[model samples]
Target: MEILDPQNTVLTNAEVYNIVVEKKKAFSSAPKDHRASPALRTVIYETLTYLSGSPAATQTEEQIKSLIRALSPYKFTGAEILQLINLRPKTAVEVQLVIEECEERLTEEQVNEIVEIVKQNFPIQSETKNSLEAAEG
Candidate 1:
């Protein structure tokens, strides 16, 4: 059997501990209620899993929160905002209006980056696929 590189494996306990400590420090210094909204929390959790290249099931709520805190400066709330924009638009004008509204707070580049992250972390599934189609319809 070939020898595997240790660096290619998962983080060691010490590394994990250090990360947690740093995360706590960052989180403590952040503005209160940065992630107080349920919608914001959901977006933060999803973004953390994507950015870490880790399975969502393996992450604890605290870990998720920590990662969110670390990325606080990004200011955008990941997939949740995308989901909102995807909601049914009664007319083309309405869709255009919504896009215009979103453009004020989020740049197209940021939105595109979030889309790419989602594509990498959560491959589209039948249920998700159908829901998105339904939302558009």
Candidate 2:
């Protein structure tokens, strides 16, 4: 697993939750025989939770990765790893680079349009905003 910079990423807890939910849906869609194994299901759920930024209870990343690798026996190719890493939050610089790389696949106009839409809708709201405003009064 790649170590992502804590500062550059803009992923909130909600995004992580959504990712976990998507993974759960995928896991559920697998064949019943594969899903029936309690040990396998546990490993799958735990691994997805950990990847989604949940604090690990006991296992280190290596240990969890090992368990998942052993239980699932599905090897991720380099391309797959790269795709997952791309889904992770990135620093401003990294985001720029990614945008550049994907510019051909997506037009500059499209990128700017999407950025504008996000900026319009997702105003930064601090967790303590409500309490702080109330206290000020």
For each candidate, the alpha-carbon lDDT, in order, equals 0.44, 0.43
Candidates' TM-scores? 0.26, 0.27
Estimate, for each residue in 26-89, the C-alpha lDDT of model 2 and write its tens digit. 7788887655368756865776666444322222344334433432322434443233232321
Which regions of candidate 2 fall more than 4 Å away from where they truly are? 1-35, 51-92, 102-116, 119-137
Model 2 clashing residue pairs (backbone): none
The top-ranked prediction according to lDDT is 1
Report the alpha-carbon TM-score of model 1 versus the true structure.
Answer: 0.26
lDDT of 2 at 132: 48
In model 1, the worst 10-residue window by lDDT is 81-90
Number of backbone-clashing residue pairs for each candidate, in the order shown: 0, 0
Q: 10-128 in candidate 1: lDDT tens per residue?
A: 44222343454455457657798652456645655555555344233233345434444543555545543333223323333333344445566556665555444434334344444
Q: Which is the leading candidate under TM-score?
A: 2
